[model samples]
Target: MIAKFLRDPFGLEDAFPPLKKWQLWLAALELEPPIFKTDVLSTVNDMAGMSGKDKETVRIMIEDAQEYSREDSRIDLLAAAMGIPPNQMDDLWKWAAQIEPI
Candidate 1:
């Protein structure tokens, strides 16, 4: 799922409309923090983009989700939410992590 999203972020929107734009951001942030941070920086440089409120809302959500958690716990939660089997989560995350930022 993370691989699919990375390959075509907006393309899969029709399949998961229930996931808000911010939720997508959270997923990217958790799955690949470095790339996600770079993407956010790019977004910031765009003339027409996320407002302060929009950025703050997603930032808060990401912070709340990660509060008092270790990396393993965070990965476990994300994997569970995506219904990925525990044994396969690491490989899946590794694959997603390798994807070049768009």
Candidate 2:
């Protein structure tokens, strides 16, 4: 489920093949405002417990996802894939807001 959800918009599974549980949790976590409060950097830093090189790759993936989310149809696609309510996608954006540059 999560694999397909992330495939197109984020290509996450590809970026981290044999995707671990934490990666999926990170996806879900990115949608939750209160939990992931800061931005993609925090998400990468907090959840990506990987080497510096791997972390950079994950960061690039996240940056790409954020850029992709700008299109409404893409947002709907992602929201549906992630089981997020269409109406609440704005809230998801709130969580994804980049507080500062990495």
RMSD to the hidden true structure, all candidates = 14.6, 13.7
Q: Which candidate gets the maximum TM-score versus the true structure?
A: 2
* Model 2: residues with Cα > 4 Å off, grouped in runs: 1-27, 30-66, 99-102
Candidate with best lDDT: 2
Stretches of candidate 1 exceeding 4 Å from the true structure: 1-70
TM-score of each: 0.32, 0.34
Worst 10 residues of 2 by lDDT: 13-22
User: Can you write out model 2's per-residue Cα lDDT over 1-102, one digit (the tens) per residue?
Assistant: 765876667653223122232333354575435233234356456544467876566555444543443343534544543556865655445434423333
Measured by TM-score, how close is model 1 to the native structure?
0.32
Error of 1 at 64 (Å): 8.0
CA lDDT of every candidate = 0.46, 0.46
